[model samples]
Target: MKAQLIEGGSFQDSRGSISFVNDFCFKDIVRFYILENSEENKIRAWQGHKLDCKNFYCLVGSFRVSYVKIDNWDKPSKALKVESVILRASKSQILSIPAGYANAIESLEANSKLISFSTLPLDEVKDDDVRYNKDMWLLQ
Candidate 1:
């Protein structure tokens, strides 16, 4: 499956605001973690899964999320096209990344926090995890 954004919205009426992604389902999510980048412009790059899916949501500040479809599991092409999107706390949305793609995240602001939802359990993550250098694919 291709990566897509699950759009969401918020409601406000003097009692503050409520943000939600109604289209995001939790049935396949077996694990989750909050990723906080201490410094701005720092990149966490080139991590992927072959059998697991991931969903990312910006909880605080802003981020640039980039991904590339893997051409080969053992050795992906360095020239693969990279796609990216900006996720901000002001906008409530979830970026769903399916299997077979490598992804990187960069914080646009200091102390940016993102929540990642995964389809695989903690025990199976190690075996399915794949990593590459931060410079594997340039993000635009």
Candidate 2:
């Protein structure tokens, strides 16, 4: 199991690596992940948000993830450098993101499938989740 510190902090993910928090029961909080592994296992990058902390796990494929933290709302930029990690489906690996972090994912293979878990139910919002092309940078 490989782990890294979240940007701007020294805290480390020392607990179970492939685990999800079972808090805030998810009867409908959009436990889904966007797919982009269409051609040559290429997935366009995109920005996504979660109502609560989220867990991303690949059940049957491989992919890369770049995690970012937008701390400045005024200037509004990504904190630190983009941390990239490869997630594979053959292994039970889960990436956990606390609420309020901007993150992007790309599929390394065409058959890549990612399963994301959220603390909020799926039906709690009129627009539960928004998808932006990986190229669209100036997202607030």
Candidate 3:
């Protein structure tokens, strides 16, 4: 499956505002984690799961999420296409990345925080986790 952006919206009332992604379903999510970068342009690169999927949401500031479909688990091709999307807290949306892909994320603003929802439980992650060099596939 390919990457998809599940768009969401916000509602502002006299008291405050509410942001939501009404179409997002948590049925398959087994775990979740938050990613915060200390500085802008800092990247967390090239981590993948062969059997697990991931969903990302920006909680604070903005981010650039880059991903690539893996051609081979052992050694992916250097020419693999890289796709990216920018997520901002102002825009309530979720970036869904399906299994069999590698992804990297970069903070576009200082102290940006991103939440990641995973389909695999912590105990089963080790077996499915895969990592590659940061420079393996250049981001466009």
Candidate 4:
């Protein structure tokens, strides 16, 4: 699995400053997800889609987007490489993850949020999602 970062930035005007970001291109965006992690509610990990590659962007605050390649599913102890990206609203970066990869999200701030852009629709994503334990890939 490979991860690509999309460039993003902010701008200002006479009235007030504004921010904007673009991926250059995102084809067939079928779904959007807004993930929030807070003290009352915590998330170690979530579902990983088999049919869709997701693009992650931190709308506010900061968090860690972790991913692992699932090419070798038979051998759980095969020592697959785990990759991570720190997403922050200040930096305004978008991370694109391809299919066949498992993802885990960790919130670094109190009220952190992540917006996910999916290639597949909700129905397909539900059927194709492969749920993995956070303990397996998440750092203790």
Candidate 5:
């Protein structure tokens, strides 16, 4: 069980965007997740995994990624909205995420595909991936 954390700064080499790759301890049983951002899951809570690590690559357009520390499980931490950046795959930039932090990407374009990969395969409702109400986290 190996845990890793890779941020956009290290992976994204684009002048205005970001991307990266990460290889964890998992030799097999990796899970691939394709997320299409819509109005429903616009605002939410994401917690880092215990055993799984992630890699994010921008197939098109750009996004604004943010993170927060988990002081209270119910309360949303500070809103650390990163600078809005563009990730053009033509430049070959990718974002890699390790297992320690929570992250969310808001699409800058109307229709964009942010390809993300993870090593641990599990359901979204599992203990590894936890999401809370954005508004709910603030009050806690």
Candidate 6:
């Protein structure tokens, strides 16, 4: 029900000379994914996992990520709280999203990219993901 930002720096990984830290203490890594946003100021919202958690690392360009707390299943759109952050390479940070929280991502630059690590595998995550209208939480 919360979002965490962890500071990271350059390190060696299978991806080569990337500004990443190969460490995860929160949860086991079930999968990794890279997402691309081809246009600037574009929004992608929203999705939430009932059991899977997520970690986000910026690989290219920049974007804004928003997390809204969904306290219970009774009202998925009723967020107990909302938090947002800007992600960019210069910041060298990673975002941790807990399960039960809905998230929205917006690209601030064209071709923005991000690497995400999840606690659940593909098939399991697909079914657990809950979707909503893009402007679902815009008014609030």
For model 1, residues 120-140, the per-residue Cα lDDT tens digits are 999998999999999989987
- Candidates 1 and 3 compared: the better one by lDDT is 3
RMSD list, candidates in order? 1.1, 8.6, 1.1, 2.1, 7.0, 3.8
Query: lDDT for model 4, on a 0 to 1 scale?
Result: 0.77
- lDDT by residue (24-51, candidate 5, tens digit) is 3335436666555775554334554544
Task: State which candidate has the highest lDDT.
Answer: 3
Task: Select the stronger candidate by lDDT from 3 and 6.
Answer: 3
Global lDDT of each candidate? 0.93, 0.56, 0.94, 0.77, 0.52, 0.78
Residue range 82-102, candidate 2, lDDT tens digits: 566677766555676665555
Error of 3 at 127 (Å): 0.7
The parts of candidate 1 lying over 4 Å away from their true place are none
Tell me the spans in candidate 2 whose CA falls farther than 4 Å from its real position: 1-36, 73-75, 78-80, 125-133, 136-140
**lDDT, candidate 1, at 21:** 100
Error of 4 at 9 (Å): 1.3
Error of 1 at 3 (Å): 0.2
Q: Which residue ranges in model 3 land beyond 4 Å of their true spot?
A: none
By lDDT, highest first, what's the ranking? 3, 1, 6, 4, 2, 5
Pick the winner on lDDT between candidates 4 and 5.
4
TM-scores for all candidates? 0.96, 0.60, 0.97, 0.87, 0.58, 0.82
Q: What is the lDDT of residue 95 in candidate 4?
A: 88
The number of clashing residue pairs in each candidate reads 0, 7, 0, 0, 13, 0
> Per-residue alpha-carbon lDDT of model 6 for 1-140, expressed as tens digits?
45788877776678776565555464588889888875554787888888888888778889788888776655664545668888896668888998888888887788889888899888887788888777768622
Model 3 Cα lDDT, one tens digit per residue, 1-140 = 78999999999999999999999999999999999976644898999889999999999999999999999999799999999999999999999999999999999988889999999999999999999998998976
- Predict model 3's lDDT versus the native: 0.94
Which stretch of 10 consecutive residues in model 1 shows the poorest summed lDDT?
A: 35-44
